[model samples]
Target: MTPVQPRTRLLFPLRRRATALAAVLLTACGDSSTGTGQPKSTLDQAVQAMGGAEALQAVTNEVVEASGSRQSPEQGSSISTPRHLSNFRYIRTDELDGDKLHIEHDHVTTYLSPERYQFTEVVNGASGFVDGKDTVFTPAQTSGMFTSRATAELGHTRLTSPLRVLRKALANPAIVQEEQDLEVDQHRFKVLVFREEGEPELRLLIDPETFLPAAARVLEDQPPLGDTVVEAWFSDYRDVSGVKYPYHLRITLDGVEAHAEDRERIMVNVSVPAQSYEVPASFQPPAQPVVPALADFGKRSTQLLQGLKYLTQTFFYFDQSGLPITLNELAPGVVHVVGPSHHSLLVEMKDYLVLVDTPLFYPERSEATLAAIKAKYPGKPIRYVIASHFHSDHIGGIRHFVADGGVTVLAGEPSVPFYQRAFSNPHTLVPDRLARNPVPVTVEGVKTLKVLDDGVHSVEAHRIQSIHSNDMVIVYLPKEKVLFVADLFNPNLFPSNQPAPYVWGVASGGLYDEIQRLGLDVERIAGGHGSGTGTMEVLRITGAR
Candidate 1:
């Protein structure tokens, strides 16, 4: 197979203006006061600004009604243009005593097609439920017995509310300290740092004159962009029931806008219904075993590929754990590289190997898989790496393969520019192989279908339309009569007897329609995720539903 070079230059210079500006700001705002005097005084002033400590203590519950838009940076069709969920209406209710939160979210997303998603999430103490059903927590979230994924997310959400932050800090004064001041857009902000146990360090920026929280900043460890700064800016403060609340909130990830909201109503000490936090009687918990506690909390393990612990708090769907990598032979030349959560398939060609979907959230998994492939295959090199889609989990390790020297990436036509831009971005925070050894990457776009035939074996790459993503690609092996896909249908999750879940039914139905359109003989089906490969019968049963 001949590699197709990009029409334009692929390797562009990395942009460092933001990094330079941040460094200059940090230098200018060096710590001036170290003692507890500044922190205590600032806390007192902030409490007075927010209707005094009495008012804050009297608040037991809060209800906020807002409208906004949220961006899925990882699930975008392209790295540059993330999947945007606009026209979002949210009703969030919080019970401060038990650290309980219930949120109802309604939004519409348009990538290839317009689809509407409406769901309710609840977190009560140690248990979490979604739409009144028990939900599975990621390995990182279930690492500790005292804390769960839901509670961690609740804390992150509460950071946007200054009242909640002040209450928590006041309750534990030892954790609050005065940090260096910050200057942004000619405005200086007094920074109050909170170092809590088993939580990410939060830097709350306060307005010097108004003493209200101007913004909240925390460092989150995200793949492709490590140690990313997540900031939430607050504005338009309004007083309600003797308490001050911010009506406008804008959240940013690494200086890029992620979510923006404007409050329509705010209520304090509101009555919360019991059913909001209750799990349904028919709800069945996942059979997966509980994850063990880490040696150090909130720190990444150097020995293991387990992702950063705080990722669960930042990203709701983030889940990376240390699972043993196992290889299974599916066909005479096809091998399945299975990880704890995600999986990858390797197809042997005439001279080299073709890998389908580098499935994981980090390069470590890809690196490990590469080592395993080299060990098993001996001298064969990976010539082509096919990306199932532009989702972060599936493509996070693609850059690693590019750094391996002679691998051409195959992606959907719409995602070609996205891969180019993502490959050029500076990975200074945690330099991976690609960052350390810069190299030009060749990304070939598959408009509808692209076939690789080498007499002995042939692999076909086809772009399919799905509600899950616009840039969806599935691989077909006609000689073996096997189809490889991602996200569309996971047979293990949705068995042949069982019907596809709510939104998943739409995605699987689209896949079924595309299969019928192509008129290819498909016998076995493999997924980028899940445990085992399924049959065409399973796809028919689930997709037909």
Candidate 2:
């Protein structure tokens, strides 16, 4: 049995800040120093304002129903319009005493096409599950990884709940609380900082007039943005069973609104069956896949899950190790680097190599790919990396190339500034290769077409117009009669018998139009995703013309 990969958006743990504490405790009683000379800890005041410690601690279970939208900053159609899931519905139940949490999410996404997604995630103690069938915990040998991930997710949810945080502060004496005065949007706030052992510090801002928690924030490391503040603002308080609950909630990343929700209802001490958190007796989770040593990059392979549409069995565990670099030759000098979920193309030039896309979120995967490229093509350095678009999955590993030294990145004109700013942001929270050994990032903007000819090999990078993304760039290899693109068309995903107006028909049609407009000869199509290269017949079969 192979372990199923949890939904990409479902299992990401928030990055923690690694910096030392900076703010000092403003007096033991908290930072309310006025001429009146009042002495009271800020945490105590916040707890009392939310119906006191006794009422909050007595509550053992909570159920919240909310609706909102989820945004993917890197996958947006343009700089101003990001890819988002609208009409989002969320239901979360927490058994505080049992240290359990369950979440149900449903939403509709309208980017290149319209699709609906629904999934359930549950974390009980050290074990977790997805869709009640796939285990999220690895084997005992790698138990620490699961523990840290589950703990971070559980801690984040608790911090967002005013009642839970207050109960935690009252129960743990070792936890330290400090106070500071800060102003945002011309409004003064009394910020209470809570620090716990082996956990990220949380800062909760209090409204001076109402004494209620205005918002809670924590510093975290998110690549591209680097060290950023994630905040959850609470408002529209309503009383339910002698306890105050915030009906309206808004979340922001670096002061930009990312999510907003309105609670339809809130229940305390709800009767939840214990079996909800238990794993089925018949189910056994597979062991974690071990990463192969650098020397065995091309020799080792393992089975792992892939794709976001796992429920329909459209995706399943396959024999493809995301750790080992697999290169498939499409032409003489063109190689397609394939992975379970994403793919990249490497083009060998006269003196240097040009990698089509850096596909993968984490830096380690990119590092592995880079190592393999160096091994295959010994002395030739990767001089230029062409970004297909601004999506995270396509450009997440751009920093690794920059760290390779003297590498230039070519992107659509509108996305050049975004990459420039993202590359310059501080990565102190989780330092990658670029952060450890600092180097300047060079980005060139391509408005329409940029050609690179080494006298022997000629590659044309063209900015194409598409509904999927305005910044999409497709690489054309005239000599080899091959084209490289991302998202616009995935041959493996489209069925030959399927009708017109395919899920990706609009974007694929746009790609076809672009090829014809440029009057370039294209025989094969390579993608930033899928397993193999496709032919022009794939487009014609899908009625892309």
Candidate 3:
């Protein structure tokens, strides 16, 4: 038997970027320090306060470890819910090895700067398969490595390692502003702001008395999201080998408190291994599908899933060797538009036409399917669309029907809430029919049965208690002795190598049950995923492999 696959959303393990760690750590720029400046300028004062440029530049290596709960971007309606909030801890080791700023993270990833050395995953116990080996993992592309590298440079330089930030500032002498007015903690103060081309806009609130950094703020683009704010407050100043640093740190995002870190010890002039940040040779990413990068896992996974929907539509829409959409005339005023993956039945009525279960895998497929339906029956519009269920594959192209003004979605009562969420959510990224042309989410929900008859043909939708999708809507045609079911029945039944989980296997779980109970005549079983016409007798007697 074919493997009973899990839901599409739970198939792949969703990945995470710095997320909680990314924004929180950039704020802890080693507390505040006092120093002398002839002009007492913002840059000079901050430089002196941070143990002087000579003291910071004189340092070699550093390391830090932090633990926090990361919010999952996928949970809430408006986003911002941690996927698994278990308070996972992580140890991050940073080093400047041979003109390269290197970093190793736990549960995250590693990076080697200057010339990005790539590694899908490099941790000793981490998991990833790359280059046909389990030891060292690498993605098909090495862009993630560069992303990690840039993040590390900003984090380590600004927070724990001050020299890197100072180095960049000195390199670009005009990047820092002298004096600016700012209010913090209900007090007015003079501030020094650092601006860069692509990097986050940094601001350092200065204490006029000691010329030390009171707090820091960074405005960064967390992909797929607009620029977000990251702020850090440093306190508990202590001297570490003649260099003062903040032992206590507080970080926040968008004015909401995120997380904090308390330093156990601050160690400078540490020894880093020769192979500490070693990575695989440079990789040249081959041209491939354009995948989107987002601020959080929610958007990334959503985008990827949507991308798969489009890909599925394209593959079936342009199958060169596959069968063309055959228009089967089962009876007068009754036809089925059969395609490679699925089929749709068209029943012409007196004034309008009724289309059963639009196999809307993609907008492309919908366009093709709707076009064929339109071509077959010239003038009449598909006034009512019977959506079998709320499966992604079945619903991806649902917008096509909604765009046809006054098209009512006839669904089961169980699927009303789902259709509501689907219709209301913002599709700003990829505007569809509902997004472009707004419409009231109209669904003629079938509590027990909903009959759409126009004097000539009648399309009856009966709610079935199917094992596959509990809220299954079986579209029955009494005159033609034909029925259209969504996932409950696969008209293209195959002989499996092993026994199927159900008595009927992948054919139909509750189809015969509903048919026998209702005593309706079902000669031909038309399916949403039917390859061609199927008979109910052959379906049951085929027997489980």
Candidate 4:
């Protein structure tokens, strides 16, 4: 497809001048302001100034080819350095016609780890399909809590696009308002706000002098991240066939940069194939990817990887977001990392640090927790890691401790084998601290109960079998009178108004009985899945025998 040549005389009177003189020129239209006779609507002038509604309607297929560096931080898997981002090359192509659309994206990164990711989506009318070669994504996967999400979203996007969004706002004069008096990052702009009940509220900011679009903002809402402000800035305006288009684009989520790209060329109204938007007849929806179990780690299937990333996303909103670690002082030298939905304990002893139950989606959680502990405690080296159980979720990042130095890992019967397998599993896709820095996984298997004390502080790993698993272990701190348990005493899953399920993972009175049988002083009860509460309070409320 050939780009439309710009009307040199009318559109380029100012000729995209040098830096200083460029500030005085207007790129969009003839000129209109308060001093002008009839105040031409900013949006109308903007639409016409950029080659009008017809130029936009002419675009059936578009290809944007650019070369720039993309940030790739294998987020939750790193230990020593979390902020490291590798550069990558990428290409994106999009096609649209009536109610059909197709999108293809390819990205390859060669850095601390070498990998390739490709994603393609096609939507024809009400049908849609998405597939990609992602190491963390498995085949036959469906997205949604209880329904399909990709199909619904892609189908809607097919009928609506940036041009369509702009057209809809212009078609409804009542929803469009010429507004101004808005300030963002200390820069004031004249804006046209478009408000529709069911559609997104969009605000288009224009340069006061040129009346050209400077930025656009959309208000999007969700449950987890709440109402988010998505904004994009347009810069380096260039004439592609008589039409003015932005060469540089930057999109930000909340306030963090999500994408930054420099467009080398954009070809519109290109030839598109019929199969581009057609969904195959033999498509079978795969269930949503979930964080995998320990066994899934070695398989390196897409399902397991998607699950791993999704699990981490469930706790931390975005991969680039900072670690959310809030330390609750359980007692002197004993701290509970309460920020993660999946918690961890940082125990400081006279000679070393003992972290019990490194939980959450992946290595990033453990790495963050380890950093927080060392930052606060400073010189104490972590010598022992008390892995409470074998459940993969309870100890996803146990290897971070091992990678730090010579750390002895303790798990109960049956779980130690899992520890060995997890420690030695293949991690070529998403390598972690232990994977990058080879270290011997020192782990101890406890049969019934095990105890370790260095005169100042003490910890005991007890194998307390429950309906949840035959090899569960509970951690106990004697001097602090605080007892830590995993699935056996998770208060978060407690039934409201109903009896303790006493079924499967939901614990029973056996935990209470065990506490009494051991004659352990347990005033405060901490957990791997629930809020730490008083031992008597949990027993009284849950009626734990």
Per-residue C-alpha lDDT of model 4 across residues 1-545, encoded as one tens digit per residue? 11111111211012222122223223344455335556566776677656676776565566656654433112212111122222333343455444455555455543223445565545443345556643322443422221122323332232223444456555667887865345566566667787765344577777666556777765432111112355667788776665666777765544545446687887777777777666565442333332223222212222223222222221122221145888989999888877545677778888888888776444556667778887998888888888766544667567666776678887776655556655655444456676677667577877888888888888887877564456667888888888887655655556523335423123546677667787877888877766755464565456445
Q: Residues 38-123, candidate 2, lDDT per residue (tens digit)?
A: 55566766776787778888888899999876565555788667455355677899987666887776756553335565656566
Ranking by TM-score: 2, 1, 3, 4
Candidate 3 backbone overlaps, count: 7
TM-score of decoy 1: 0.66
CA RMSD of each candidate after superposition: 8.1, 8.5, 12.9, 19.6
Model 1 clash count equals 0
Give model 2's TM-score versus the native structure.
0.82
Model 1: residues >4 Å from true position, as ranges? 1-71, 76-151, 154-158, 163-211, 225-229, 240-243, 254-320, 362-368, 400-403, 426-440, 451-456, 495-501, 534-541
Candidate 3, overall lDDT? 0.51
Judged by whole-model lDDT over C-alpha atoms, candidate 1 comes out at 0.68
lDDT of 3 by residue, 416-442 (tens): 655554555554434555567766647
The residue pairs that clash in candidate 1, if any, are: none
Tell me the lDDT of model 4 at 356: 85
Error (Å) of candidate 3 at residue 365 is 2.0
Q: Which stretches of candidate 2 lie over 4 Å from their true place?
A: 1-38, 111-119, 132-156, 281-322, 497-502
Query: Could you tell which candidate, 2 or 4, scores higher by TM-score?
Result: 2
Q: Looking at model 3, report the run of 10 residues with the lowest lDDT sum.
A: 108-117
Q: Weakest 10 consecutive residues, lDDT, candidate 2?
A: 298-307
